[model samples]
Target: MSLRTLSRNEVANHNTPEDCWCIIDHCAYDLTGFLDAHPGGCVVLAQSAGKDVTVDFFNLHRAEVLNKYRPQLIVGVLQGEKEEIIPTNLQDLSSVPYAEPLWLRARFCSPYYTQGHRKFQKAVRRFFAENVNPEAREKELDGTYISQKLLNKLAETNILAMRLGPGEHLYSRRLLGGVINGREFDYFHDLILTQEFSRSHTRGFQDGLMGGVCISLTAVKQWLRDDDLRERVMEEVLSGRKKMCLAISEAFAGSDVNGLRTIAQKTPDGQCYIVTGTKKWITNGMFSDYFVTACRTDKGISVLLIPRGHGVETKTIRTAYSTSAGTAYVEFSNVRVPMSHLLGEEDQGAKVIMSNFNHERFVMVCSTARWCIAVVEECLKWCNQRISFKKKLIEQPVLRQKLARMISLAESIQAWLESITLQMCKMDYEEQGKYLSGPIALLKAYSTTSATEVSSIATNIFGGRGLTETGMGRVIEMFNRTNKFDAILGGTEEILADLGVRQVMKVFPKSVL
Candidate 1:
């Protein structure tokens, strides 16, 4: 990595296209050989020849781009100069103010987080940074499915199991090579994992990364009557042998669960059912091997575990985000499901379906809040790196006010998220269902709504770059486009806000007359 020091006067002599050189991040690059191969072509290089182009370079490219061409293009350092912006180390916590949650900062403390949580966070962050992030960016852009090889790595590391949160599944396992015992895993660990995945900022790939298994398998474990069936499915999914998705939302019904049109008919023999229904906007549906489905029965709505086979069809449905999410329109045409595969009871499926909502929304809140904060980080970085009107964006009083609000929003979201997570850690399923549901809903609603605000302000700050899909404002662009997914994914902000108020209303105090 060593390079010889060269003076600006020395570098100025190489101005010709035949021997082009430029300074970026205090390092002198020999762009002569790279000119023809540059993605932006020789024109920009010719314009930048023999000049210190650090600001121009970053304004047009991410730091990683320099790293990509470092060995070949970087020839020397500018004499007596050093870089202020170092290439990012994925394993390192960001130094940008409020880029990370308060608990993660050096001096700030949260009663909710512990040393075990810290250790687990570091290990998990490093693991994903090394194993998953490169492919995440690639798959997110190329709109391809996540690979089995990486899925297996997730399984092998117990990352897949951890994503399912604390359960018997994690009891006997070692997490991230035993950085923390599985028995010791708590909601904080789960929260950390969720936030780390979101921090990667590959929104579509986030869902494709076993998101199905996280939301669907819990129902199988909780409601399926046949112990062997539940165990088999869990093993398959946790091992990445079979993928699963919760297929409940239909074209006609989403948040309104009862309005679902999918129907399951009991056979005369009473041994099986013929499920006939179409599910729209099913995440990971295109690649799922098993679907934890919802269907109307003779009595009421029932949850069913239907495998992908004859009569089961999935067609990709493009959303605002990448197709890497495997979002699909699913049709279950007279698919036969064993009576034993019924989750909970035939008429009591609503209980099973609703039971998953609290936890599912909780996880979504974790992701949503972290995603918003990550956008704040990107904005903060942009404010520092991006120069406008002869000064950095951060120096503008009005822009700084916008940032103050952003940082405040980010901090508030994380604080609320951690508070809810702490409550979750202390509460069991029934307790959470009774006491925490309303607050969690409110939090999810608030987080997504706040994200909406953050994304807009960020775009305005980035101006034209924020609208561009690639380059300096790509993160802002991606966030601006996909922030609505969180608002809609768990439940729309309106639905959740209503649910939150309604839940509290159930116990509202009667006015004194």
Candidate 2:
């Protein structure tokens, strides 16, 4: 099936609705059957029938839109014109230096990644680049919840299941459009999901999409008893039927378990518990059906799975990030939940919370590292294209130094992230909880602090455009505005730094260096 070239006159002759055609970037598209399906309606297509719409199309549609609509709609190139647009292929890594991590560069090899990792990485990257990024700006600005259509799309690709960070749920499942077997998924694969998804560059919408589930669900799957209930909840969440979030921080308490005011009391019947508390700055709380919550029990700090009920209420909390995150302040008044919903044991929740934090911090590390890379990419592209004083920004020595620092930080953090993720792949759950906790905390602290520097340098390089929300510097601006999120969330920098030292001291030799 070879493609034939169509003459301008020949294209003009197919202007009728029965045989409509249009030109986009010198390529002829037979959209007669698709006119009715056009989101802007048939009249728009009919009006442009037989005319070159390269400018108009590029103005309204992303460069990738043609690739999305091409297979079925494109007919051929105009007789004497050449195709100017090339579709993005995720399998193809960026040739630009520092644009992608070392493993993605030419002739580079990673001890941790196999062909399976590469395949899954390509699939996930393509999925986000094509599906998520196109709508991210709108959702981020408008503070709209992720659409069900997108959720269904993610479900179809097994993204939701994969985000849970390798477990029995993925043992027998296919992933990333069947590019990789779930049985082969490792921490590297999990790292790929976090890094690639963050490429959307809309932090708030990224969290709203599924960030909560990625963290909260770990506690559920790892600690919850009652096999049937756990299975049911996992199925519902992974299938995009129900939403869940972690509720730990409160207005009065942050980074302090003892400071929490939320409390749950057991009923005399011993079948249920009554929960009363308020959680503030909770990610995805406004839209969650279940809260993987921490509270003070009669014995000690505990965790419970509290379903949304009559006494449960949530109000939106606007942060530096968009409300699309579903960030909320939640109130629970006498909410009754079955004792079976208790995670781990009655008073041993400190361990349960500790177990989840390792992976949570790891996830943050992966995202923050990639975010730094994105900032570097933005600055690099800008410096190359932006002119100052009749010369490109890249020609300036000071600008080069800024780029060098940003790239150095991004690359260093990525190396640390990969090393840590490799350990995660080899270690079992308890082992990771036991040994990796301190390293993860330290890595998170380092990466986030590095990100602050990266963000500052990037904003300086971007100048006024860096502060603006739209246009070329949008990503830099967003990073500058929200990079503090990584520094503050999961655990504050000072707290995590202190925790890392404390954990190290636990194993410190009697005779130290």
Candidate 3:
């Protein structure tokens, strides 16, 4: 066979000659230099070196490598080849990387305990001060004031740490700082979760909390291994270097732990599992770096980390929220992941999943409660400023009564969340493992539904302006979107209510008997 020549697209995109042709089994193959950037390793590329290993490539490497790294590499044309089977794993190379700084890693990774030590607090405070201010008019139009502010904070934290070259330990510290220093980090967290950072901090709290769930999951998974995937993910998360989202919910399943339809069955070769199914209502579904997804495996339900691209198609769905962190309908048609990507044992995914849900639910409650507090504060501020017929809205007894009720509702949720958060802080994983599932469900249900009510009251108080996009109008929009999401994601209110019933049933029967 004559040596195939490289296509203009492939030749232009190759980083180096060593990375020129990724040969698979001596067919003189070229896969566009995706191996080096592969989170799994360069070995995946090495395995495919030298031949027309096309069949093996399609069966083994297509979904695994192409989907995740296609955006980064370029495949040159082969000599004497009639048709080039563009790898099934290829991604669109159209997306551009955000020009964020390297120091973001250090800020994100820095430990909370040490944030006050040395100049860390000062530096972080300065970072937030510089970035968290309300935006200029031009900036405000392009991005929402809240989102711009939060992004500024996120960018500042990410860029500074990255420039400082802080390691993973420090990066973790920064993540804690963002979580604990409510005043400084909470806004950004809210923005991150709700994908509405550009809209209103209070409204975006749910999205930020959702993002936190994925972040926490990444952290936990990192703790499970010391490999390159762990290192890369840690580096990305700590420095705010990479953006990712989770895919846990499916079309037919919504908090029904055992009803997942996505399957990760082992291939006949026993080398990998062919993951096939559609994941719906996935947060960050459209724009995530990789998906930490739950799929039914032969051993049970298992969580697998699948990179986006290739055959893993994503379709964005319009929702009440406009931020479009790109909630998507993801179809994994025969997507394959090696055994290494499996989180925990086969079929035992429920145990790992349950544990994660607890943290997720707790964070969601705390964040949503915070949003309610913010909404109440905003309403109070608005009431103070706007006067009707020579009197402030706060002066009206009816409005006062409504505000009081809103405040009370917010406080109730906050008190419960604080109590639960404190308990969470005290328990070891093993201890938490024992009691988290049920209470978490209850907390999520209570907080989200309560937040929705608070948002509605706040909107009513704002009247017509609440329906617009000016002043506190943004807050109303965010609150409305988050209110809907709160009852859905993590665990639905109905699901949690059912869980509460089950919990009560388990205990109440004994007393009655």
Candidate 4:
């Protein structure tokens, strides 16, 4: 059915409290009923009545707000007008400068991204924009875990397996409608997926959505002694029938993995380990079915797969981001984990734990870099549109400099990230732990530091809206509040810097001055 067409005069004629109409992006909205329920209030709607409110509406409201209320509010299109330039679909990439990476921009070419990468990127972006973004926004605010329905969709599409990064794990699985063959997947594809997933822009909820499976399942796939046991665990978690988290941090230990006090004593019959420990700040723990946990044993600190069962308990731990992450304080009270659950050598679990860390931090870098650019894009849009003191924010010299700095930081970090990602593609896991750890560490440290700076500059650009939880500047506010998680979660900025330097020092040559 054709939508009714209204002329400027027709829209103007309804300009009253009882019959309010306004034009936004060449579309007429019958907001007569919505006025009372408008978040900004009826006065604002009444004032906007009978006018083309495209500028005013976009200045204060995000495109998403329009998407949410459009069905009920929209009554017709402005006669003889077209909205060809308006960007309404969240699934499409932004035209705003620096909104996307260089490779994704028109007329820009990269040696890294291939045809498959482009196709896969589009598919993944559409999937999140359509399937995940709605739920993430709701869950981020409500402090709920990822819904099973979404997880099932993700699993059915093999997205969960892809998040574990390219390997045998991806073998035989048709990924995202077979846009990319699993056998040919590489770290670049992994990078693409991680960045796309983070683009959901819901920080804590991003973590809540099967993030644990990404970090924990790799350890199970690599170090579990029994192949059957390992495959079983992987199938369960990746299929979304079961959930898992990496349990390494405790009250007494975080960066210092050796300081863990969690104890695991062997049973008399050698059937299981009686594990007793409390793991703090575990992502996705609140709803996890398996915990790839670190514990102290007869020999030394070791890693084990502790299933959630009798004597296992989880308590929520609220953090700077939403509790949607399921960050929890977990207690294992004499939990009986079978001998078959041991990962790697009993005492050499540090090796297994260390194996996952490089990739974990690499994933963190990918997320942080993408998120920084997303914020830069947000600031760019706001500066271009938001007027202050008789001019758009972009017209000011200081704000321009801030935008310049934000852009430089974001671009440099992404470049470094891509460099490291390519090296990861070339190296095996052991080789990566040996060669790329320091560079990745340095990259993550710099990435997070850049992110912090970007967020700070964005807040200044957005002013009061940067502090708001809704409206045009909400993206800026979200990044400001949660960008620090990158610096803290994988490893502290200071600790990573030190590690990066230490890695360099390991091969340093002695010199006489």
RMSD of 4: 2.0
On lDDT, the stronger of 3 and 4 is 4
Q: Ten-residue segment with the worst summed lDDT in candidate 1?
A: 504-513
lDDT of 2 by residue, 28-119 (tens): 89999998998779998888888887766754455556888888988887877777767766446665678888898888888888888888
lDDT values, one for every candidate: 0.89, 0.88, 0.56, 0.90
Q: In angstroms, what RMSD does candidate 2 have relative to the true structure?
A: 6.6
Order of models, best lDDT first? 4, 1, 2, 3
- Give the per-residue lDDT digits (tens) of candidate 1, residues 349-401: 98998879888988898887887788888888888878788888889999999
Best by lDDT: 4
Listed in order, each prediction's TM-score against the native is 0.97, 0.84, 0.63, 0.95
Report the Cα lDDT for residue 374, model 1: 82
lDDT of 4 by residue, 1-513 (tens): 368988989998988989999999999999999988987789999998888899888778767688788888888998889974354577788888999999999889988889989898899999998899989999999999898999999999999999999898888999988888999899989999999989988999999988898899988988998889898888898898999999999999998988999999999999999999899999999999999999999888889999999999999999989999999999999999999999999889888988788889999999999999899898888888888888899899999999999999999998988988889988998999999889888999999999998988888888898999887777889999999988988789999999999999998878831
TM-score of 1: 0.97
Q: Model 1, 398: alpha-carbon shift in Å? A: 1.1
**Per-prediction tally of clashes:** 0, 0, 55, 0
lDDT of 2 at 353: 89
Off by over 4 Å in 4: 1-10, 25-28, 67-85, 511-513
